[model samples]
Target: MATDPDNPPAEVLAALAAMGFKNTYSGGYTHKDRGKVLDLHFQKDGTDLFQGWKAEEMEANMAAITALFSGIGITITPRVMTLAEAYA
Candidate 1:
């Protein structure tokens, strides 16, 4: 069977939920920082899995996510986006 990279495995999602991350639509999830929303998207590159998000918010939640998933061996990749790209 084929699996979608954007949508992580059930175990991963469950693990993340257990760690207090809120599951958003589809493969998206978010962690709140102060009044800001740290958006996350699970993506796949070949057989490797990684999380993608806007660079502006990377510092806000990258460490937390890395720590949370380090034991599980997941990679987090930041996506650079311009203001127009981000807002679009």
Candidate 2:
């Protein structure tokens, strides 16, 4: 099951909320606003980036997330974006 890193399903977000993960981001599928920060492409725009939730958010709900994802046979492991290249 390949899931989109940019947009997790609403159902999943809903479940996450039921399990105690709350956020004020765009549809709960994005990180908090990175105002005035350059993106990976060096663009000084798009403060509200979208690429699923932030790492810290996941870290805070790892146990619940892992358990939920595992139920669907999806094993998720969190790692640094730069360091994740090694695993690839």
Candidate 3:
């Protein structure tokens, strides 16, 4: 499997777009005395993921990404953030 060990979340999201995945949302979660945790949400169809040519299999592939990242020392947390504070 091809892997990008040094890829950042924004890059991953861009890659998803390049691969035809649609962007659904972008937001962050607040942390006390720290900063907000950010994420970019994407969604796509999931019928030809293994083939990797169609864009209609993104959701399934994204789920697989979540699982893969989870196993590879990454954590997924769903939370809310204020855009005003985030930009500042």
Q: How many clashes in each structure?
A: 0, 0, 6
lDDT on C-alpha atoms for all candidate structures: 0.51, 0.52, 0.56
Error of 2 at 40 (Å): 18
In Å, residue 81's CA in model 2 sits off its true spot by 6.7
Pairs that clash in candidate 1:
none
Candidate order, TM-score descending: 1, 3, 2
Name model 3 segments beyond 4 Å from true. Answer: 1-8, 46-88
User: Using lDDT as the measure, what is the rank order of every candidate, best first?
Assistant: 3, 2, 1
Candidate 2: segments with Cα more than 4 A from true spot: 1-8, 27-60, 80-88
Local error of candidate 1 at residue 66 (angstroms): 0.8
Higher-ranked by lDDT: 1 or 3: 3
What lDDT score is found at residue 47 in candidate 1? 24
Better model by TM-score: candidate 2 vs candidate 3: 3
Deviation (Å) of 53 in candidate 1: 14
Which pairs clash in model 2?
Answer: none
Top model by TM-score, which number?
1
List candidate 1 segments past 4 Å from native.
1-8, 27-60
Clashing pairs in 3: 44-58, 45-56, 45-57, 45-58, 46-56, 46-57
The C-alpha RMSD of each candidate to the native structure, in angstroms, is 14.2, 13.3, 10.5
What would the TM-scores of all predictions be?
0.40, 0.37, 0.38
